[model samples]
Target: MKRLVFILLLVFAGICCSCKNDDDGGCVGVDCLPPETQTGENTFGCLLDGEPFIPRGGVNPLDCVYQLIDGERYFNLEAAMNDAGFNEIAISITTNAKEIIENQTYSLVSEFEVGGVSGKYIFNGDIFDTDNQNSGKLTITHLDIDNQIVSGTFFFDVIDQNGELREIRDGRFDMKFTR
Candidate 1:
């Protein structure tokens, strides 16, 4: 029955090959945004003006900093991406608040000295930031100080020099921090 065995093997191979999953990096439907994960996956993504703004390249596509400034704890997280032409686009959240705990929502203000959070967006040499008039919120979903991992979600609106408001939404990041 050698002939019969050969035919069965061919069928099995074809079935196995067909069962291979074609996953496009955890994409879901039309919006190919990365899934929101609390684990330290080092992922950063958001929707900028309704388009996907996922950090793609650079020495550090995703980075976080936790330090003490003048006896006050400071925190900063930055995500950057280089486009096809090498233009850098970045988004950052910073705060010098005394404590950064989980499940806390912070307001994104313009001034860091005012004792609140701040958000910034840089694109094509233009810098936009949150101000009293244009602001947003950042919610810390997970924070592990000993392990140096942090995960959060944020959204903000910033005004450019031309007074054009840019919207950044559906943002999420999970990464390890450095001191």
Candidate 2:
């Protein structure tokens, strides 16, 4: 009976080891692909401090909000890395309808003034935003106004309130804007 019990324990161990409990930094869902891979609908990804930074929505949920204000189109994309407020990131891009066309490139400005395409990275205590000191570019690879599908790539450098600079690279977003 002891030998039989030992055998059962081994079987249970094997089963437990074979099960997959997939997750992405506490975010659950098949859409939560391993951070190394970056491709999804309504997805945004980049590298932060040489680590994969993929944004996800939780109970509060991330949003890709779009609006046409004063003849300019604004696209605001946000991702919550965690349930905590300090772990979120926001990217806002403003351009005219003509500038947002497919296969076009738009300049990313660090100015806090109007019509600036900027990025913000917020961590436990570190926060950074595009300022007039840095430069970046955004390329629109696809835009479907009828279906409201917008896809783009971007990279930028932002400065923290304390004057520290952080670079965000390999950024990509494929989102259907919510009007």
Candidate 3:
């Protein structure tokens, strides 16, 4: 009986180990968290090519960068791995926005730029400002003007410099701004 119990225990351990090593050793099956709904604790994550993309510039409590210039508002957010080989995933939004409110949807225009870059910027090589062929929107779901906390969801399809169309989806952000 003792030998039988030990064998069963070993079998259980093997099953557990296998369950945890799903290809990339990340969560497997439907239990894995979707990137759009994964934002908690003032962090950001999204899906690119069905893989998890989280911020790599260290987990910042309030890393969402914001700026106001000439009656326009801009927001920039990014994440990357520690290695230089990894491309930094980033998004910048520009608006003639004033008094941000919940449920405000802004269409991302191709001509919008900040510091010489377009509004719908992507780090994926060959991809530039969202091509004129597509349109994107940024929706503000929550705004705490007193605390300066903001939450939003966005997605865009942009053409690369080579004329290839790329889709970025399931994106979400919750951040606090200084200004």
Candidate 4:
């Protein structure tokens, strides 16, 4: 009876180990985030107020757009997800700069101006943005214009019109850009 019990315990242990979550491509926990990569894997994720915010749905949840207006270049990176009630939540980072260079960091600002960056959070039709009272940083780790791939990391605090504050942290994205 002792030997049988010991064998049963070993089998249980083996089963528990095998059932552990080991998916590297998926978020692991409540505070889990997507892996930061320089390749254009169309991945985007962040932590919103300590909860994981990952883009969902089947079509174009992550997007990067590069445009040239009045001879000035600008880029917009956006990630969006749908909640349980089908409400859309999104985060957008836009830069009003002449050019985007690799290994450069941009400041999040309230107003749109030359060489300034802006961050926005939209949920249920309410928009919050980084203002003078709140700010954040976006660092471009890799930018390949020829291949149209861009990767970056960012974190910010934004305020809505009603003065509600939302903290976004550990943000990262790797995606292909469209010009």
Which candidate comes out best when scored by TM-score? 4
Alpha-carbon deviation at 67 in model 1, angstroms = 1.3
State the lDDT of candidate 2 residue by residue for 1-179, as single tens digits. Answer: 99999999999999999977655545533233333222327777766545556665545345676677667666766655663445545444443333366887766664355555666666544646665677577787877777777787877777766667777777777877776
Model 3, span 1-179: residue lDDT tens: 99999999999999988875454356632224234332334755555445555555634412565566677665555544332566545545444333445888766655444422233545643336654567676788877756767777777777655566666666677766667
* TM-score for candidate 3: 0.64
Worst lDDT run of 10 residues, candidate 3, spans 29-38
Native-to-model Cα distance after best TM-score fit, residue 101 in candidate 2, in Å? 2.3
TM-score of each: 0.78, 0.66, 0.64, 0.79
Task: Output the worst ten-in-a-row residue range by lDDT, candidate 4.
Answer: 22-31
Give candidate 4 misplaced runs (Cα > 4 Å).
Answer: 1-31
Pairs of residues clashing in candidate 3: 56-80
Ranking by TM-score: 4, 1, 2, 3
Per-candidate Cα lDDT values, in order, are 0.82, 0.63, 0.57, 0.84
Q: Pick the candidate with the highest lDDT.
A: 4
Q: Which parts of model 1 are misplaced by more than 4 Å?
A: 1-30
What would the per-residue lDDT of candidate 1 be over residues 1-179, giving only the tens digit for each residue?
99999999999999999875843464543266777888888888888777778876678777789787677788888888886688888899888654678999988886457466888998875777798988999999999988888899999999876778888899888888887
Can you list the residue pairs that collide in candidate 1? none
